[model samples]
Target chain A: MRRALGWTVVVLTALVLQSTVFAQIKLGGTKPELVYLVTIVLAFLEGPASGAVAGFGGGMAQDFLLNQPKGITALTLTLLGYGVGLLRQYVVTPSPILPVVLVGASTTVGVLFYGVVRFLLGFNPGALYLIKVAVLAGVYNAILTPLLFPPIRRVAKATRANKVFRW
Target chain B: MALRSRPRNTRLVVISLVMMSLLTITLDYRGGQSGPFEVAGRATVAVVGALQNGVSKVVRPIGAFFSGIAHVASLQSENNKLKRQVADLQRRTAERVSLERENQRLLALAHLEQTLQLHGVTATVIGESVGNFEWSITINRGSSSGVKVDTPVVTGNGLVGHVIEVTPTTSKVQLIIDPSSAVAARLSSSGETGLLTGQRGKDLTMDLISVGAKVFPNEPVVTSGYQGGLYPPDIPVGFVSHVYQAPNDLTKLISVRPAVDFSSLEFVLVVTGGSSG
Candidate 1:
């Protein structure tokens, strides 16, 4: 319980900053979705149970903050988190690119699902807009995977003294 | 415990993810019928935002120091943008003063209305939409502030976006730069008209201009004052950033760089409309 709670805290903090100050820091014309990056890391580092739980939680919180339709982020993130957890056993590169690529691919799937749901429900996400956001988010998050991995690993690692930071 | 259990475990994992995601989608479609799990998540976000707000106090001084160093790289663009802002501010101030003088002069003969009131509430940007494709901002006002959907938002400079969603104390503004947002606009300089639509990110596409229209690089844009006039008039939107004209095309595509930096928005004005024309 303590470990799960701790990791959840880290993910939540990263999401907040992802939308606040860090959201403004653009590199190569795209800002990294730190929440999605962190969620992917959580899913991979933890198992499917933890991954889905965290993914749904993170997605709900993020969507709420965004004032977007409820459950949109939750659904999309649950898919990505679970998929990442499953793919964790298959990666061979052992590099940041692997995580980035995986993250980008999954984020694309997630956003596509989200866009379709939105469009069908009358939100009307134009094709031009969808492609731009999905592609750019993938690239940006992929690039930041390396920088994100270490912190995620550190927090996920169990420590006897610092229970709050343990995942 | 056994090889057979491994496949079962995978199935269980996939099933669980699928089930939870489906439930989420259903609840979401029903519009905010949150499960207990989702409630916990929102609380978690609130706490995290609070914690980050505290940590930012520590990070702020360091960030400022680094920003000082970083300012060197951004200095040129910053200087130019600041210069333009200074000029724009001077113009607004002059207009305000002149309007004040005119109001006094007309006080005896006319029943003049006050300057245009805002259509929505004001908000301080607290967050931004994650990802490169979608453009939105989290403001410090929400349902509690009577901020509803599609309320026109603006800044001192020009059109920003409309309100998308609202909570108790915060709301999200979909920037005019997002690919999803479209606003009818007119050129302040040449009076040529166009439809302003969002492009990839932080760039707008002004379309439907006649192929022979004499549009220039720095042609200032404002709201069209048509189509219900969601946005007010004379609000400087952006500059002509790029123009794509191909042979044999009846219309040319012009790209505009918005005046307000959606990426770095800190404060905004929401024009909540309820006034006499």
Candidate 2:
């Protein structure tokens, strides 16, 4: 219950920041997806199950709270979370650059996945444009990862520690 | 057995979640705004909107302060330019009194008051759409404040968008820049009509215009408000920035720069009612 509450608060706060504050601060006509960053960080710390769950919650929050096709983001984030979490279990890296690299690559992949889904759904805005947005958003998310990763990591660790103590 | 069961359970959970996401997508795609999914979405918006309103109020001043600092050098030059313009305007005001009288007569003949006399409910912008492909905003007014879905929203300069969803205390506005948005527009100078549509991250394009029609750069574009149209007539939409021949050769393509600076919008007026003559 405490874990759920903590994730909920984190997701809600990220949603608010993404929509209200960061929405105004556009970089090259694109805004950073803070929720995506949080999800990726949480997944890296917690593992596959937590990653998938966090991605779903965060994606759903985005879908319901913002304007977009409802399930597209949820679907994209779920896959991304699971994939990243699975990868984390194999690669044991202590490098500070891991988060930045993983976030940039995942964000790009997630965006492309979203665009392809939208295309299949007959909402294609053009492949070139989608590629441009994906690349730009990936770069923006990467730039933001260093700032966001540490706190997210701390929160995930603290929550797990509490859970272990309870058990 | 316990370890094996744990892996199986994890796999089952992942599969279940994926299926649930697919189900949601199917339902949302089929049911649209009237579906059960929308109810959940609306509930979330209502709760988040209240929090957003408070946060926006607290953050706006800080944002403005930083923005002001960033533009300090440009602002000084702009201030001087405005001062010179004000002096020129003052000098022209005396000579333009008779022209204003003549213009008012023409405006009355044109029945301009019908468009100008709209009853508006002023609302503060609480949040912007968080998605990459969507251009929208959340306002702090809703059914409680006489705001309704489909009501036109405008800033002082020109049209912003229309309300798409309304909760008791908040509403969602689909901005003119969204690719899904389209407005029936007419040129102010030639009165040539066309369909104005948004191109994602690009200037608005006015299509279905006659190839031979004369269009000049900077000509104002206003809503045509054709019969059964969503918006009322003569609302300012944008200005023509470029005109080119369509690839089809049967029509002309016109680019419009929207009158509203969507990125900086803080407040907007919701046209609740009034006649459009």
For model 2, the superposed segments whose C-alpha errors exceed 4 Å read: A161-167, B66-115
The digit string of per-residue lDDT tens for model 1 on B182-259 reads 888887767878899986565789998888888888777777766576666656688888889999899988888897
Displacement of the residue B251 alpha carbon in candidate 1, Å: 4.1
Q: In model 1 chain B, where is the ten-residue run with the lowest total lDDT?
A: B104-113
C-alpha displacement of A149 in model 1, angstroms?
4.5
lDDT against the true structure, each candidate: 0.65, 0.79
Q: How many Å off is the CA of A143 in candidate 2?
A: 2.0
> What is the C-alpha lDDT profile of model 2 across A8-95, one tens digit per residue?
8888888887777777666677878777888788878877778888898888888887555578888888888888888887887799
Clashing pairs in 1: A133-B133, B119-B271, B119-B272, B119-B273, B120-B270, B120-B271, B120-B272
How high is the lDDT of residue B69 in model 2?
A: 45
- Could you give the interface RMSD of each candidate, to one decimal? 5.0, 2.8
